[model samples]
Target: MVEALNKFQLIGQEQTRRYWETLIGSGRFGHAHILSGHSGVGKDALAFFIAAALNCKADTKKPCGNCISCRQFLNLENQALQLIFALPRRSANQTDPFTGIKEKEMILINEELAKKAAWPYYHLQIDAANDIRIAGIRKLRKDIYLAIDPGTTRVIIILRAHKMNMEAANALLKILEEPPAGTIFLLTTEYADRLPDTIRSRCALHHVPDLNWKLIREDLLQKKGVDPVQAEICARMSMGDLAAAHGYAEQDNTFWLDRIRATLNTLAKEDFVSVHKQVLLLADKEEQTDDSRQQFLSLLILFFRDVALKVKMGETVLWATQSQQMNKLFPNCDSQGAIKAIERTKNALERKVHLQLALTALFFELRKHLRR
Candidate 1:
């Protein structure tokens, strides 16, 4: 087995670590644990680590990496550790042949399907919680009744547990209330408020706060080979989200910089046609998925927000990277107009308007603001 130290990275969660140790040491390890936090806070990583530690057969306080149990666990041969993920439902465009399988029957990660699932811009639909489906729940009931495997504990890690619908949630509640012996359920969610009170009550809650900027910067510098200045900048912009920081680090910022520059330049010149064209191009690129469209709209909002901040603060702009461009463009633009445009865009997103129409209308409004 690979070393436990090598498999997991636990940083800045000393209290949570103690809590887990106490639970395990006292032998009162609850059947259900809910790990809640903001997105990109490493909650999922923590959940998986806890699951591994519980199933490990190390003689020490923690899992020893060289044991037979650890070897099987690392190889994913420990059938006791199961993962139930929220999968997108089969739409007209995409379908999974094995959609009806029970949670207990699922053993292998379908790599091909996983790649398709990871396609950017796909939103989590309400119907993706197959593990919580009536059929799935019945199967889980049966599985729980079976005797525990010797030297192994059954564990189920459910990602985005809040996505489960009312029926699914109630089913899960039943399992939580009277979970079978030697079974552990680890639930992770970015939005815990969506979960029902009854369901939340059954689980031990652990809050995972966002990673500190210092840690984020260090990780970027040491692991990603990012220069100090760039790492610091991305870390600040990410607002404690390591995932977002990593994404920013990987992205080619130059394209976005040029896009924003072009937008400002055209608006300043009152070139309505060019403005419309650019917005349409952006909307077209985002047409593949609702999530992508939302993301693109969010980026535009941030760009305009930075512009507004630059105009208001003059030399005290927080986003220094865009300050020079702001200075060059602000004199010719209307601050109130920009603010109104932002409001309209946000309103459209909140209303769940179609992506193409919303963006087209947004740019049209922006053009009016530009001329004013």
Candidate 2:
């Protein structure tokens, strides 16, 4: 995978390509590079590509996949290449089932859970500044200084460089300022704001944009065997986030739609008790996962948004797919009331209110817009 970077489809960043090519052309491939973008973008993919290009054995522009160096890069067996991933430390109660009881017990007994779990873990937690203790910084410094394997350039890929505390950042800054020979550092971050100015200044930056919806939808259909209609719907909803689109297409969206339908039906029938019960069910189900809550809320928002869009455009309401059946259920709803209800729902979501509370409130509010 690393060897493939030089030739990988970088998707959207043409400018980034020129920047990297210029660096490579100048024999400065050993310099540190930073790839920053929003979550779900292909930053990590590009990092691997860059690493592969650096180590490519091709006699020409280097990452020739056919060369011996390319083979080593492909196998990820090259001693010169080191990949360190900094994942968040799991809560003490959460242990890999495969680990022995002793390991599990050790984690339970460990007293550092609170401190370790305070901040979301990034790709690299090396904080050379105020947040990183001197000991941790010293260890990283030593690791950075270790001699590279003979005849091979060392490449270190840091997955989330933003998680570093001040102490860790300072320690890293020192190395970046006076980088060792034969060393190339690759830092990938989703939240570039959290990174220190000094750290950002030391490395060349590359941006990876979200994948195009058209391409993402096609990929889903071709690679994942998703239905074309479903793929297009998911693609539009995901707004180019391929991972989210895939998840939406793979899951049973019908379940959520059914729940929304039930809620609307209960409200229409003036069954307040049933509406409360339905809200409870949704809240209970969503309590299991943040993803569930997010999906439910998103569906509800889109439902109302589409309804509002229809009313505003003065288009026939039949065009609103999700709300089409609601016409007979609430024949008295006025445009002003519908718009207000939509605005209220949007505000609740923006404020991060509890999903059930938001949904229940929206239901009652919608009653005002419905026929008596």
Candidate 3:
């Protein structure tokens, strides 16, 4: 069995790719492995590629994605592939993993899976589904030992593995200690240290590095068809996280950017009424207020960053297209104070403080600093 980790069309974690290629090429396809990294760093993608490669039947470059097994993996229809992740808490009387799941919850889960199938880098999320329950592991324990195609390699992927509750973690540990024949476990998590020492000791752990900003930018422009300007801006702001850059690209940033520019002028004049109204509008969305506010703050940070860059370096800025308006608003921009204020508000927001209050205080601070 040549269980080599062939290239998976990944963006750029060269070190991880080399590590896996060497391990798999040695024909020591271990029982369990963990690919750990921060969110948006392509751990899920690498795991999926490994699963596909394991079952691929190609003679030469494994995961010759056209092979039947690889196609099944790509379509997420492979019977030999078992995917596990966090789910809503099961009822006390429920024994089956799917017994107590609501229809809406199931629909949402399927939708997220579909998105993942389309793009392996897509982050899977379910509202209020915070932890993996023990029932799911018990179910997996039963299924993995059952009958399967003779040539098929059973690959079990547990995404966000750190989200496993204590009971689920213990149950999974037992299987990891003595996994069934022809079965392999692949776990991906942002916080690998959260796993018990015993569990970590049983698996080969590999760290997946964050994507380069240039790789992200090119992917946005070429793969996602994002406009060059928007792609450049989002990639520059993503801090080496591809998923965040993709999300930023999808958002209608112009709406928030216009408001930010207006808010700056309002603050400079100390127009409390207009400032209060603008903040209220941003904080009014009952469900999306957190994400909306964060997006607005991120854009504001970029705005001030451009100010500093223009003032000091005389270099090209992200919003150079809007130079006329920026120059009018920030004639003698001093962004340090304003940036500090924004960072403070951002920290408060993360702590679940009152959004409106935080925004109002931020505006007052910005007024003092940016007023010419």
**Most TM-score-accurate candidate:** 3
Runs off by more than 4 Å, candidate 2: 1-15, 26-30, 59-62, 87-140, 143-152, 229-240, 243-250, 257-290, 300-357, 363-372
lDDT of each: 0.62, 0.60, 0.78
lDDT of 1 by residue, 267-351 (tens): 5565667867776766674443444444444455556655656634332223455545655655555656766776677677667
lDDT of 3 by residue, 1-372 (tens): 223222244677878766775766677888888899877888988888878877888875666777888888887778899999887775753245777778988998899999888777788888778888888899998898889899888999999999998888899999998888899899999999999888899998988887877788888888678776677667767877888889988865555657776776676575779989878877786645677777778778877877666633233334564544555676765677888889889889989988788888888888777764
Best by lDDT: 3
Model 1 pairs in collision:
none
- Residue 31's C-alpha lDDT in candidate 2? 74
TM-score of each: 0.62, 0.63, 0.76
The residue-by-residue lDDT of candidate 2 on 57-121, one tens digit each, is 66555456566665555555566665543323333222221123356444542323222222111
Position 200, candidate 1: lDDT: 89
Count of steric clashes across candidates, in order = 0, 15, 0
